[model samples]
Target: MLLGSDVRRMLPPPAMGRFGDLLAATTSDTSGLADDMSGDRDANAKLIEAFRQGVEQPI
Candidate 1:
């Protein structure tokens, strides 16, 4: 019972509006190919590398 309540509380907030807005923004920027995580493996690799560098050397 305690574990069940903790699991439920760990879930993200029910913000449909905010999620929709974010989805719209991502799709708009990704050119409708946002669902293809493995379709553009090279692009994905570059993106991950860029993200890693950005995190390691912020600004």
Candidate 2:
């Protein structure tokens, strides 16, 4: 997932614009998905720290 994110980040502006258009066309509603994934910010930070310490998997 991180690698995919990195690849998407590397897309050129025109490619990114097309990607966004495709996504918007396919997805009817993203707000609910966004809300579902919007976890605790502090917990996320702690999890990231734990991953960095090798105590947790990146996934």
Candidate 3:
């Protein structure tokens, strides 16, 4: 979901760099862990709407 990308994007530069290093050491493809949010817009929109609905509901 967009939350994962959003959280990664929020990471400090130093931490993000470290994460990239770790990914490089363990995985052949680290593109998914990149600090980019250029993911599926439609999926992100649906997630946002679901989140909003959850927030508006009572506990």
List the candidate numbers ranked by lDDT, top first. 3, 2, 1
Query: For candidate 1, what is the total of clashing residue pairs?
Result: 0
Q: With candidate 1 superimposed using the best TM-score fit, by how many Å does residue 51's alpha carbon deviate from the native?
A: 0.4
lDDT of 1 by residue, 1-59 (tens): 34323433444556534543454455454544434676676676556444333333312
Clashing pairs in 3: none
TM-scores of the models, in the order given: 0.34, 0.37, 0.36
Cα lDDT tens digits, model 2, 1-59, are: 35435545666778866865654443324323333446975564444334333311222
Q: Give the runs in model 2 whose Cα sits over 4 Å from its true position.
A: 1-4, 29-59
Whose TM-score is higher: candidate 1's or candidate 3's? 3
How many residue pairs clash per model?
0, 0, 0
* Candidate of highest TM-score: 2
Q: In terms of lDDT, which candidate is strongest?
A: 3
Query: At residue 29, what lDDT does model 1 achieve?
Result: 47
After superposing candidate 3, which stretches have Cα over 4 Å from the reference?
1-4, 29-59
